[model samples]
Target: MPAADALPIPVGAIVALFLAAFPIFWCAILWLIAGMGWRRLANAYPANSDPPDSADRIRFATLALGASVRSANYSGSINAWLAPSGLWLRPILPFRPFHAMVFIPWAHVRSVASERRMLMKLVRVALGGDVPDLVLSGRLAQAVLDRTKAKKR
Candidate 1:
């Protein structure tokens, strides 16, 4: 008969390993965010406060920001709010490290165009100035466009 020996991991070692990995993980996330142009978006449309209570919220939305080549895809991780003033977007907690909530005013949204991609429909929103375009599903895009139109009236 043979018995197997069990090895216990030291609590301090586990803690130390986590401490060392945390910063690196955070840095990598920051790099990814920056690469996806979230930093640029933040610079242009930083949301200092939360979305208004009256704003209509869409959870688990899909959105793409920046150029298609280097876009940041927040598939099912986006919380989008449609207000009379603008469109508010923020990522879920885990993906929110360097991504500040952004509010792109209707005035800043230059254009909204709908296109069919294969079987799915998509909307491309062009913003003013140096801000990159925002691509979202057709439904969300329609909501945003509706808000903008309402604001104009």
Candidate 2:
């Protein structure tokens, strides 16, 4: 009996195969994200704001150097600047064109609460319905609350 020869692999066939498999690859990625649970991104950075006042003494978050920040549509924390106007949450990584700075105006913040999760207390800032909430360490949270409260006074 003659040995069977390998079938010729055509470029067109290979392209067609990839085209068929691409949707499956995309679906698998979506499925994985959904299975892991989808958390909405938060935009903690605000837009076009005044510079920090020398006399007012803004409270910058030292701990925010590597903190994870989120808004309604963003993930990962950026450095924060607490001015009398509001809290400016900007990307820790520099000059990200797409990443936005979220400015949570003192008026926009509905409340700040401390909750225990993962055996740690986190300060949760509720930014009303227009934005997602922010969770920070208790100390930083207190700092935010103080700044916002001071603004009201």
Candidate 3:
């Protein structure tokens, strides 16, 4: 046999290719699986607005932060705010640019779910259970508004 034909492919090279490609394949599979599951779950829920035409309709979800409400401007357009306690959304066009915030409004929201256990697990791994505050200030705002309305009557 020729010396060139006698040399075998190295195991290390095969492993190196697998190691490099595995993550990308793993992530792609995970995303596809999660997306399908999510799509099914989403189909199970009635659209928060059944008619789908009403801008007034709002879907409820927990917000991880509340500071977005004060600093974010909602003066002109309909806005949705989420925090750990609850959600706040109003219909209007915001005339001013908001600061000190990255806001994700409800109108722009496509889906939500309580993955707190998963988050807690990640937090435990990364920072040893030092969980950040997940207060729902948006719901509190609604509650206060309700109470004020009740008091006025």
Candidate 4:
């Protein structure tokens, strides 16, 4: 079907459709491209180890802003933190302004030694709240902790 003839078009619906479709579309594109490259790299050599024993106590370093240290291992996965409505998570690179993007595998942080605000920031962000660039949603932070705790059993 032609793009225009498929359905009735309203200006607001068009905008909503774009908003709904753009991220999923781009993420798929990026994942396909990145996954292809990652597969090639993995094929060239053996993996260092298995994915994980069971997503156990994997401590991830967090900066003051609550963002975990960036890693090249990022694959396309959605992670979020949860917190009360007041906080938010903002993505950022070291020494740079915040970003709205969330990268995965790299962001699959597993543990922390102490409780901190940056961690809270991450929780806020994960909950899809308006928070600083480098943060996680509080809900996600707890989920990570819970996952680790479960692994101990």
lDDT of each: 0.80, 0.52, 0.33, 0.36
Sort order, lDDT high to low: 1, 2, 4, 3
Q: What order do candidates take by TM-score, descending?
A: 1, 2, 3, 4
lDDT of 2 by residue, 1-153 (tens): 544684478789999999999877766654443222122223334466544654232233432221233222223334666666666665444323344555556777778766776886666777555344566664466677677666668
Compare candidates 1 and 4 on lDDT and give the better one: 1
lDDT of 2: 0.52
Structural similarity to truth (TM-score) of each candidate: 0.79, 0.50, 0.24, 0.24
Q: Which ten residues in a row have the lowest lDDT in candidate 3?
A: 121-130
Give the clash count for each candidate.
0, 18, 15, 30
lDDT of 3 by residue, 1-153 (tens): 658765386789889989999877766754453242222322332234323232233334223221233322222233444342223333232211211112222233332222234333111001112222223334333543343344447
Q: Residues 31-57, candidate 1: write the lDDT tens digits.
A: 776667778888999997888999999
Candidate closest to the true structure, highest lDDT: 1
Looking at model 2, which ten-residue stretch has the lowest summed lDDT? 33-42
Whichever of 1 and 2 has more lDDT, that candidate is: 1
For model 2, what is the error of residue 143's alpha carbon versus the real structure, in angstroms, after optimal superposition? 1.2
Candidate 2, residue 82: how far the Cα is off, in Å = 0.6
Sliding window of 10 residues with minimal summed lDDT for model 1: 1-10
